[model samples]
Target: MYSSHIKSVLEEKMWLFQLKYFPFYAEWMLMVLPFIWLITLPYWLPKFIVYLLEGKHLVIKMLILMTISLLTIFLIYMYVILGKPNQEKWKNVIFDQHIKRIAIKIYDATDNMIGGLVNRDVEVNRGIFYVERVPPLYWDVLKFREDKYLEFTNGSTGLVGLLSSPRAFNGIDVIGIPSAILHRRGGGSSLSQQLVKNFYGQDYFRNQTSLNKLNTLLRKYKELDEAKTFYHNLRENDGEEFKRWVAMYSPSLVSAGSVYGIESVAAMVFGKKPKDLSEFEQILLTNMYKYTHYFNGKAHENKCQKIKNGSKIDIKTYFAENPTKVEALIQDIDNWDCTDKPRVPLAFYKSMLAEDTKGQLLIGNPNSRIWDWAGTSMSILRHETEKYKIVYPNHLITEVKITIDTPKNISFKDSVNKAFQNVETKLASRLHVNLDDDAKSEKKQANIWISVVDEKGAIKYIYKRGNTHDKRRIGSISKIFEAIALGNRGDKYDYFYCNEAFQNLHNADGSMGGECQDNSQNNIYSARKVFGASKNLPMMSAFDKYVVKDNKGIHLIKNKIDDEKLQEIYESFNLSRDNNVTLKYELSFGLTNSTPYGLQKSVHKLTHLLYEKQLNYHEAHIMESLKYKIVKESKLINGGEKNSLFLKEIDSKTRKMFDKNTKIYMQTVLKSALDSKFNGTLKGFKSIDGYEPLFMKSGTTDKVVNEKKLTQSKWVAGAIKVKGKRYSLVIMVHSENGIGKKIGHHEIMKPIFKEIVEALNR
Candidate 1:
């Protein structure tokens, strides 16, 4: 019965272990099995029995049980402390209360500082709960006033308010002082020491004995003799100390402004004194203003002079001589009256002197010219005469000649008519106005005359006109002729010719006779020699050799002639004792062939050659390569229709490859060409012949035709067209000089070429 009861009790204890720790034992069987075995011997014996045991087996069992029990206790304690086993309910209650308190404080502070209501306020009597609400006020309002601060408060669980208040008490007021001062003061120094350091240096109060002596001397004599003596001694004893004293006591001697405690010294140095308090303030203020304004104005004047002179004048000497000019000019500009009839007043003139003369004095009329009103036209003229001495001196009044005299008690209509008449006959040409024929009749009827000369004996170029149709036509025709004369003419052709011709037509002596002829040569000679050599032969070829080659291509290479040799040939040609017959022949054939038109045509050909090369190269690389035999057979069979048909087929196939490759290459080539030739070095060459060389490389590509598609598209169509058609070629030119207008030659010739090409293809 006793054994049975003991077995029953062991069974009940085993069942209790299995129920309480069975899952953990199963999961950590390897970890728990040894510990269970270690404690099993003690578990079988009573605690008192185990303690009484003294044999080796009993002692070992007791030791093992103690080790296992201690280990188990340690693990359980760790689980309780670190893992918070069985503590979630209590922890949640405590943490919720803490969070609620913090949230309430934050909300209250935000409402107190910022004038706004918070959203989703929580009532936190015991614990915390999450609630969604609007965001806090934005920070941008800080820009309005720095002193403002926002406070937030939670009145209940779902409500909040933001109030504005001073930032000082809420803990952010000490941020107004400059960062430099704050940083130095934060380094643990007394306020008095900081003040001294700001006015003087760190060593000013370091010596107590010296400071005491200075204090006693200042008290007795109202002057710090000890301090003065110390500084004097430092001047003799230490070179660096002497420099510091000089810098502090006499800054104006070595620099330009007063140093700390040096205002009296500065006055003494300048040998000036104030009679009264106001006088003292005024003198100091005036001196300060003068130094700042004078030096800065002088610098600005030097800069302006440098810009005006560009690479010609030295700025340092220029400013030294005329420091006050820039300030005067700026003052004048600021005071200018833009509301006057001409929108220019006395101040405008003063500013104009600086701008126009660039500091130089004006002795004659500066405002009379077109440049005073138009900057672009002025720039154009300036560029043209950059090497010449053209001067606009000062403003001058002039009397102009009119076509009709002023009538007595003139009616408005009559006055208008008289003005229009003057414009048509005299003023219109100069002013660039156009009048109709009916306006001329009004001029004759009104008896109006406009003076073309000014009070200063200067000539006026512009005129007013009457309502007569003829007078109106005179102005209109003048503008039309001006436009036509300026179009597409070569640079070598003299503008003086057109100007001279216009003057002569008006029965006036030509203004260009001697000055224009100084640079001019016989048109025929220039055309035959210069144009022929530059375009027909190699650019480096001699005139004589090129002339010889003109009759035939053989003489050019045989002569081995160049530019140096060309000069000699030209001199020889000049010395030739040619009769009238020979002269006529040279003039007609040689000179005329080298005319501007001929040069222009030659340049056009060169452009065509370049285009051909580019197109061929692009087509060859970018097009689908067809077998030569196929193209050849197609061409042979299609004989009469070969060129057009072959080009069309090749173009279609090439267009596909254009997408895969040529699109990018074409863009690159176009941009390079535009940069290199159109917008860069070639920009100034507006004349057709001058632009010819840029396209020369393109012509060379025609000689080496390799791809069937290129041959078909470029050669077949181009060759056929060249043989049978006289296609009109168009050219475009751009210029910076503004000597002439832009020309779009292609726009004019497109229709002509279209008709010719269409007829030939049909």
Candidate 2:
């Protein structure tokens, strides 16, 4: 009875294991059965021919049945592998269109972001792998090092070998896969298979917990199909296609704590371009293919063990006996340098591989040479996709090219950095505190945020000193949206009296006021002036008259402003995850909570719309031109097919934010706000030296306690044209401790504007 019970328990455990891994076992079984038949094919061929000559009807029937069975199994396998993975369930034909909006926004915001893989100059600038430039020895060594059993020209996955040999889906050596799985042995893969895995990500095949054997098999099959298709289509032309393949699929190397292209890796390791690398350096890089992370100048314990044990075996003998030690041996060397540098080729071919006792090697790991220069633009892309609940594949070959207008000697980063430094210096001077003094209370310190966008909708510069995404009271910048909405309602030029009765509560000192106020009391202002001058009383009167509609006698001011109009604008700008519905707005101006980024986008859109109207151009024309160029270029990259993977489709029906005539009118009104003759608040800031034709508006928010007002927020938001290009610059300064000391926008922020213009001119 005891023996029976023990037997039953063991049987149950085995059954559970089988049940859990059924798909895994079934996949392997299917492969192994074919492998057996493949091995016996030569023997069966002679007999099969004899049967055909003898006209054996039973043999023909058996062959038909076998073909039918195989076809059914193939169909089932295709269905399982080709079906969309659960991770990408959110993406479909409809939701894919929204991806275009995100892509365009990112393209605009990252217009000046430095470096990327998709640049045309990558081959010359970054030294990414090019067919002509790469040393032939690199390929010879790669063949010997990674996959020695077959010729590499059979395409990425070695599809020919896969069909001919008894190997796995990726053409892994029959003996290798079983050893690798059972004993944790490492194995080689075809180049196409490796590239496919790289497309999935670094850990897609490397991490077992994240992907089980069943999923790996499925993924491997899919990779085979993709690689075969891409290779056949692109290589048909027979010129630079291989280079393009490498450019697209190679994984990035880690350098300076970030993943970068081949040039960065080369700089980190040898301080040289790939073409300039010595033979020893080439060998070292080839060796790094096995273990990328192990090459970061860290001592590998396992590799070092063999060195410590003083093994004197030659390279061929050692490689043959201990294949696993190949990577360990290479990594444990002095700084990854070859000790026998002068005789590198001779030693590599003839003698034993050795390590250095005195460590001072410059050798580091080399990853597959793929460029990743998108920089901050990638963050915007991520935010938008996440907001829309879409899982965009990371490996899509998205391109972003910017036509920088700055001087060649001065990079975008350097110019933007200098501009911000000058602004920080100005802010420090005003606060009378050291800019580096972190101990100062946050409330007492002034925070300035600047965002610049060009007429092409590209965000050329953004202040990186503070969190631009932190939602705060946007103050009168909200009036841009209000003005556009009211313009749509044909009330843009409607005049309203700046009533003192509707003003904000004044401070005892009579310096500033809170919430709602129009200092120009009793003056009549149009909606254009209300926006350009940022007159709160006139804006409120216009908002109450034009926007706040009476329905069922229930107050709908909050819903109309916050829920309907503001939400639409926010969504149009694609402000990631901004909850406009919950925000409470008592009047038209100064209380709309928004990020500096969002405010900048709103101002940029308004100014660009005005500029386009003034130039007699339409936004739809620009969108269509951009869309056509992108789609055409994308199709070229993907071998003359509109790759479904690319987010190239954009909505053609673009709604004009404001009427063309209204925009033209607003442009003049905005310019008037910067004119001294109009008694504009920012008239003093009009003379920006070389960058003239300045149009601006100023906004201020104050808090009153015990009838004492404290200035909390101040803004100077507008556009300036330089060299026939419109650039909208939005500057916001906030203080936690009330800045009761009065300082006009002209006096406080004009210097920053001048510095920015100087940087641009430089």
Candidate 3:
């Protein structure tokens, strides 16, 4: 009973193994079978005997065991390969399927002139059906037969050299068959054999990452397996099959349309037919099968040498065309650019087509990168048509579709120009900015920046009113940056306002400028407390402790910003880090400097971060992407809609500007500042009465007048939420008229925003 059970188990295992991976079992055996002789040779027995005479019985057992294992492998190999159908026996295999009908459609951009009502057959387009395939053994391809001599037989075609390795190569003779088979990748395959596999290969084993034979084996197996069923049914004795493939795969005139077939490429590249190629020219043509770019579109000495070595033919012979004039013609072709396609334009190639239709319009010089998107798309259409071939009688293609999704909505240039002019006029008339003496003065500068992005994805921006990209000292709006500075503290240091850190910041008389109203000793305030008051003293102290880390090298604060996060913030703001923002440890940073073209861009980024909690990260990002796509395809941004990044030109340069990760921690700190009582800089928000609420931070600074007194340069930067829409508001206004007395964000800057929001809402 035990013996019967073991026999059944062995039989079952063998049968299942053979059934599952029949092809690998056969091919791998064909690779390793010859090496089995090393184990089974009778010579090993003599060696075992000699070893035993020398008292080496261990070696004898090892040899005997090795022989048995080898025999086991050899028997399995014999079973798989010997069982495979031979060439002669393939004739008996029958496939009952009828010939496949193929439908052809021609496209010109998004328009289709052919197909649908009028169906076209694949074979009808191709002229000169294939007569027959010369037997592989009869093909004689000799390259560089001798120096300056290239030769091939009269019937030899380009496929012979493209597909086959040299005939003299025998893996078993060069090196043992096993090493050669594994290393050389099965040596070579005849052109016809390769063509059969390429056309029918099931691609079951094709892997993106797999290399060489492992990649080929599974595909070959599928091909051979399919061939077993279809070899008798499918026939390519006529040129129709060859023409379709050559047109589809080998030829490409313009990539913009379904321009297929070698006839076009041949006319465009060589200005001649494929059959008329000289021996050396044919060598150039065939080697192109490996890489078109390397040989055809490159023209350096290295490129020249690569083609010479790859084809084993001389370039001089190829360029000369006449053997006697080889050396003289070498210089002529050497100077030629590989991409300088034949002078015959694409229109000429179309004129050659039997279809009475003229080809698609050719734009740009043919030498430039031809549009390849449509050409690549043809394969899918072909595959789909094949699947439904029987349903579409006469292999009819009713429709050929081509869609190009390019960026549109060129620019919001016209609307933006008119809107900003209105904002400037309203501000000047309402705020009464004085343009009298200053307007006539030497390049007197004033910037009117009105930038607002609505919830509906429209961006309206007007930079430095006069010179948008020019530099200007932006007023107290710089104070909000303290949120970033405070986040980088060494320890949770209390705002020690004892005036100890302010000694270096003393005025000419040794008194600090603008002392804080609260002069309490040892009264430490949180960073948030200082930010609300816009205190410059502790702000400078923090900068020294957290940023510069004073001369004594003592870290008065912890949680200092690391290099990486600091870099990210700096980049987001477009702030210059290489230049020290301060004069020295004792230096001061005021309203602003024109280090970058505009301050509005930086403020806009900060305000974007304020929306984080209210914003759905995925929804915002995907909507941003989808809206951009929709607008790009549709060429319009629906006005009054919400959830938009903005309407700007379609460009990749500004895409990274919409970062949700811009200022995360600062958002938490700023929220409290905005909610603070409407006093100091934010006093202006109270004037904005509407259905919407305000979240904001403000800054106030005065520009010195006559170098003795200063005039207020009021500023307010924030966002207003009305309905479901959010409009970011940044207003920087320096009155043309001098301030008779002190003013805050409420008077000039705040009113401008209130009126602008009203204008936007209407």
Compare the candidates by lDDT and give the number of the best one.
2
List per-prediction Cα lDDT, in the order shown.
0.23, 0.45, 0.38
| Candidate 1 whole-model C-alpha lDDT, 0 to 1 | 0.23
Residues 29-109 of candidate 3: C-alpha lDDT, one tens digit per residue: 654654575457576757754564575477776776677676755554333222222334333321100111122222333
Clash totals for all models, in order?
A: 87, 5, 15
Q: Sorted by TM-score, highest first, which candidate order results?
A: 2, 3, 1
| Candidate 2: regions farther than 4 A off | 1-137, 151-254, 257-378, 384-395, 402-448, 481-500, 503-535, 542-588, 613-665, 677-679, 704-708, 735-743
In order of appearance, the predictions have TM-scores of 0.14, 0.51, 0.33
282-343 per-residue lDDT for model 1 (tens digits): 22222221122111234434533332332112222223466575454334433422110111
RMSD of each: 36.0, 17.3, 22.8
Please say which candidate is ahead in TM-score: 2 or 3: 2
In angstroms, how far off is 198's CA in candidate 3?
57
Residue 246 of model 1, lDDT score: 24
